[model samples]
Target: MRVGGTGHRLLHAETARMVERALHERLARLPADVLVGVSSLADGADQLFAEAILALGGSLEVVLPASRYREALPAECLGAYDRLLASATVVERLAYEDSTSEAHMEAGRMVVDRSDVLVAVWDGHPARGVGGTGDVVAYARKRGVPVEVVWPRGAAR
Candidate 1:
């Protein structure tokens, strides 16, 4: 799965759980031949997708948005993030700055291009933040990538 957006973390409490649960449910439907490429940032949806992929015995590729994990996210999620990196079959960095940086944005395009499935856990709204979650989704759609948008049902985007 090529994951996009920040709905995994920024949603309201229950909303986060709902989106996570939905992601898990969606992952269960993927075939065994599928390889899940997960970007490692200890936020909400991305981590949940990694866990689900691991549980399903699928191969995981951790694509970090930056060369160094420390520079990308906070100290708290670092432990879980490290565990993810360790378990991944392939670990790569974008050789850029944070996910929102220009360099990373170019890198993100490659990530999405490689994905057979795109799972976007957006908050049902346009991104007003740094990460190009919205941009990633748009790219995936434009490329005719199969996308499953898991957001609150009635929320606006």
Candidate 2:
């Protein structure tokens, strides 16, 4: 099973906990041997989904939006980002040199295109920017990719 993810980069502590648990539960349903998580590994939900997949003994396939993608992440998220990147079973780097919105959306499109299902941690809102969770969800829907939204009750960004 191939699952991709996209969501907010900033999440409240409690909301993150809820989202993480929800991601774990959803991904846990898949057989570990066949499970493969595809992600861009952004700070919040993307990292959460990857972690869940790793915890479940699933393989991770990373798709970096640009060559400078690591520099685009927040300082606090750097450590985990590096760790996850190192752990990826397969890593694909895009041709772009800068981590711009266009690169991000293209990366998200790549994930959707490679996925059997997209596990979105969106809060049922419009995207704040061009490549946000909502935009990814919309693209997934347009591409006819099955999307399982995993916004836990009482969760907020």
Candidate 3:
């Protein structure tokens, strides 16, 4: 099964660990042989999910929002992003040259399209910006994609 998710960028350390454990538990419930995870490898939840997938021996498929994704990402996120990209089974970089909001939304769309299940690490809030996690979750729901939200107790952005 293909799984994808959207989450916050500024997750607290305790919250990150909780998210990771939740992802691990979720993946453990699935058949490991055909497991494929799709993600943008963003700073917080995305990165945690990717790591969980890899730990469980699941393949990773990375979807970059734009050509300049590396430059546009926060500096703290760059290392994890690069590491995940290097380990990815497939890396799809959107045609956009710049990392604009449009590009981000398009990338989110692609993630939902490629996923059999969309895992959202949301806090039940409206989207804060054009292409935030909430927006992606809404898009996935609108498209009829099954979404599994993985926000653990005490988890905070």
Expressed as tens digits, the lDDT of each residue in 14-77 for candidate 3 is 9888988998998888888889999988788889889988989899999999888789888988
TM-score of 2: 0.98
Clash pairs, candidate 2, are: none
lDDT of 1: 0.63
Using lDDT as the measure, what is the rank order of every candidate, best first?
2, 3, 1
In candidate 1, what residue range of length 10 has the lowest lDDT sum?
A: 1-10
Q: What is the lDDT of residue 91 in candidate 2?
A: 98
Q: Local distance difference test, per candidate? A: 0.63, 0.93, 0.89
- Local accuracy of candidate 1 as per-residue lDDT tens digits, 1-157: 4443223444455766676677778777877466465555446667767777777767777667666546566566678777877888877777675445565456556667667767777754555544456766777788987777777564333
Q: Give the TM-score of candidate 1.
A: 0.80
Native-vs-model 2 lDDT? 0.93
Which pairs clash inside model 1?
8-44, 8-45, 124-156
By TM-score, the best candidate is 2
Clashes of each: 3, 0, 0
